[model samples]
Target: MTNFFDQFMSPTYLGVPLMALALTLPWVLYPTPSSRWLNNRLLTLQAWFINRFTQQLLLPLNTGGHKWAVMFTSLMLFLLTINLMGLLPYTFTPTTQLSLNMGLAVPLWLATVIIGMRNQPTIALGHLLPEGTPPLLVPILIIIETISLFIRPLALGVRLTANLTAGHLLIQLIATAVFVLMSTMPTVAIITATVLFLLTLLEVAVAMIQAYVFVLLLSLYLQENV
Candidate 1:
């Protein structure tokens, strides 16, 4: 209400933690399967989508990596839910906050690196130095690789935050222009509204894609360690 940035800030009511509520709200939207032999169309479709997504996501992973299925699935659904829900009117998007995104990225990324180090320290540490490097460049290459490794989490959080924030800002700006020009420039207002609609659709696709990419990247990190 105060400014455009206000919309992206974590919402609060009185003293309640609305961000937690938003995070959990997506679970309520999903339906639970019944014990009966037959399933409803919604349940069937949901199951099918999740199944196919999981299969595809894990395709490149080893059997050892299969242990992460539940985590990966839950995370994917959580992210996908919050992202889509955030697109709705009068709702807050938790993923757009760099703090929240980094909270997720750091832990998951650390887990992958830890797994690699524990299971195969030789190979894990080896990532910091590529194979067959010239004797003179080993230290420089190690430093570069180490920096790159640490940058992964920062990149993940920033990427998600920046994408969602930019999309939201663009939509808000266009919608504002549409309102401001409606009386004096009816034709232009209509054109702006149309652009807003198309942009909204693109943002929706972006929401889905970003969620998948976040999980996909995590899976890839796990793959290296496994």
Candidate 2:
């Protein structure tokens, strides 16, 4: 297990799963659906829809089809992959690393803010200021808003990092205890092992749930701000 940890922690390989996950999840969830019309005419319905409504006719891709579904599922799948990857014996959970979690959270936060500002330029700053702010309070309000804007990404990063770090450490400690106890007596060891097994299962579920929750929050932020 120690050897396994060393191998898993190797820098060259540590990020491969994250990269593969980013690409593979998007592909798997948004795989191209087959159609006779597309094969015969070389014009996929999806492509045609985009060409007609989005580019030519000036419309948004809000038909609530593969585009939206794929966006959501992709986020969830990537997070889940990262979360579960940690559960594999000896693997260092990427989410437990603040830098990795920050990498994800920062981009999402920026995207939400940038998209909102771009789409609603006039209202974006005002949204932060609120209507009741007094004339003298405008400068203070601006400072507060700026801080809040920055805090969003920081908060997201810390939240995931804290959760993963604490959970992984707890599991490791429990497993260690069970192993030592098992050496002392077979019967007690068996019971301890059973508890460890249950904790492992619970840990897996928590990891997945945390990933889902992270993505869900990002989606909500996008929906609200964008």
Clashes of each: 0, 0
What candidate 2 gets wrong by more than 4 Å, as runs, is: 1-8, 11-69, 90-92, 134-138, 185-188
Per-residue lDDT over 1-226 for candidate 2, one digit per residue giving the tens place of the 0 to 100 score = 5532333242445545454443344345433657554443333654554344223211222332223344555556667777887788744565667777788888877877787788777767776687988999999889998788779888888888787777777777777777788768878878878887898889889888887677666665665554
Which candidate comes out best when scored by TM-score? 1
Clashing pairs in 1: none
Whole-structure CA lDDT of model 1: 0.93
Best by lDDT: 1
- Model 1 Cα lDDT, one tens digit per residue, 1-226: 6698989977789978698888778889899988988899999998899899889999999999999988999899999889988899998999999999999999999999999999999999988988899999999999999999999999999999999999999999999999999999999999999999999999999999999999999999999999
Which residue pairs in candidate 2 collide?
none
Stretch of 10 with least lDDT, candidate 1 = 1-10
RMSD of each: 1.0, 7.8
